[model samples]
Target: MNIVCIAWGSLLWKPGPLKLASGWHPGGPLLPLEFARDSDDSEELALVLCPGAPLIPTYWAYVDAPDLDAARAMLAAREKIHPGHPEWIGSFPAVDGAAVQPEIAAWLRARGFDAVVWTALPPKIAGTEGRMPSPAEAVDFLAGLEGETREAARYYVRRTPAHIDTRYRRLIEARLGWRPLHEAAVTRMA
Candidate 1:
């Protein structure tokens, strides 16, 4: 009965350490505690729409989707508008089933995404047959807070629009092979 947008991207700000990871929203970034401000926090969800960073962080936005179909359509529209937007991974409609990592991998591959960034994937979990969970299944896949590594934070943020030949990927790849840090942010960090 819940709807979520599962995306991977380099967030505007770094997630830093596991204990330091903060929840984000359109209003501004927020911490998980902020969501717990009320008892029915689970009913609410967020949708991240950032674009073109060296590495796009893989994250999930849990929005209240009373109609899963409608939510999926909305997300599809967003993807078409900005497929390269790091968070454009995909909209996931959570239902009763085990996690499917291969499905996600196939989806990325089909979409030309060579890699998916994540804090880490455990070897096992309940209701899951050791299959990898997409960002949507992460919270359900893991037992506790696992620090999101800088390596894991980075993802394919189309520094600019992309082409069929992957001119964008290659151009950026030439400038900076592959890492989580953004071109500009890297200099700032340096």
Candidate 2:
């Protein structure tokens, strides 16, 4: 069964529960996860579109789930928060983004999103695990923000998610004992 997980608002701090359940990390937001400035290629991936608020009035589905019931159960997790869909899966233009501090802008590049961008590149091939982000990174970042106070939300939404910069690294290191990917140093592209 192929399941897709996504994280939009505050949950973007982690790569969503479904992403965790998928046995991999979602690397980051959609653009950074799938279209690396260094990727130089792109494809139409089955996006797990969470259509609705993180609190209520949400729904979800999968293309390869055994049935709707299973998909519903998967989304109905107390731990995972909101999960729903109406995700737009289609051809997206991808390019090898800068090999530097590039994912943030890349994520912004993929913006105008209706839902959260969790799993962009699902691991359809064998042996390869689903794309996950660095949990260590998230932890470190959160540690940094441990005492910081956030400003008021610009949008009508009260709170919005920020900084998944160093997330999901710990899980990758812990579960697989795999060293984290070496993030290329980067200057913000203007």
Candidate 3:
């Protein structure tokens, strides 16, 4: 099966164990994304799909898996998602005839991919799971981070793909001056 992995954040730059058959390409589906998830252990306000967040362009690459199940397993391993929480790793056509994100599903079909997979971790903040912080709250959370944690948070926001601009990104840039780093700078830092 022709499978692809969708990404909007860390996966674009640091894919870790997720093997891709091709380099990331722009013009992936536009999804509602926001920096609402408080990353586990890192304290970075990681990006995740938010119901009412602004639609932003994401990136995609063909996965090197042989089938949908293998694709999902590879993505889950890359994202550190335990097998118990399969929902955290979203998949299209999860079951035959099952409904998934219609828009993304359509996009996938248009691109001739048999299936797509992405990280689907929920919004989290201040130890409260499923809680989505406002743009101001997200900025405050980043500002509150200190030392290495603060640097990591800054790096995440700045290294995010330039095309994946979102509401919180603008607020973070205006307030905390964490603008997206240019591609050359990002490559040099890598």
Candidate 4:
């Protein structure tokens, strides 16, 4: 069997050891992607696929699976999803390649890949010990960092793709009271 892992953020750049059966292709607007939720694993805000917000650019890659059951298990495990709370995983229809279509959920269900997993962390509802910070709080937190940590945060914002509008890289800069890195880079080059 084959499974598709829809990606729009860090996963596209760093898939780790996860095997891919296909190259990344434009996956149609299936869900909203953003860096809104605070990451329990890191000080930085993490990307989430949520219900609200406009559709954003996304990519998908295929993975070969032994079976549907194993595909679900492997995906959930790979995405670090809790088994008890399956809502963290959103399953949608598989597009033949990069093509976009509506009602993908129904299509996937018909094809027996209904349990295919995509990760989304909704606002609030502590996936960790405490409630994840809101986007505003995350901005404040990032602004308060010092030295290398601050530079690292700025670099992360600088490197991230701009299509991920919800990352609010400019908002982070303005909130931090700094100029945009791209502008600064341009100034340096001149």
On TM-score, the leading prediction is 3
lDDT digits (tens) for residues 1-190 of candidate 2: 3443344332323223332333223343433221111111111111122222022111112223454344333434413323332121111121222122233334434544222222222322112323321334322322332121211111101222212221232332344333422441111111
- Model 2 segments more than 4 A misplaced: 10-20, 27-68, 77-190
1-190 per-residue lDDT for model 4 (tens digits): 5676666655565555455666666643456655566555444555665546566766666766665455555666766667775555555433213222343464455555433445544554235423545667767767776787677666656555555666455577667654434432211110
lDDT (10s digit) by residue, model 1, range 1-190? 3333333322223322211112432221211110000001121111232122122233333433346444543544433324333232332222223233444445444544323222111222233422323333333222132344222312323221121112233433454353223343321120
Q: Single out the weakest 10-residue window by summed lDDT for candidate 1.
A: 31-40
Separate clash counts for every candidate: 11, 27, 0, 1
Report residue 157 deviation for candidate 4 (angstroms).
Answer: 3.5
lDDT of 3 by residue, 1-190 (tens): 8888888888877888888888888778988898899888855889998887778887788888888888888888988887777888888877433336655888898898888998888998888888988777888999999999999999999988777688888899999999888663222121
| Runs with alpha carbons beyond 4 Å of true place in candidate 4 | 93-116, 124-135, 146-156, 176-190
Task: Quote each prediction's TM-score.
Answer: 0.27, 0.21, 0.91, 0.66
Lowest summed lDDT across 10 adjacent residues in model 3 is found at 181-190
Global lDDT for candidate 3? 0.82
Global lDDT scores for all candidate models: 0.29, 0.26, 0.82, 0.55
- Clashing residue pairs in candidate 4 are 93-104
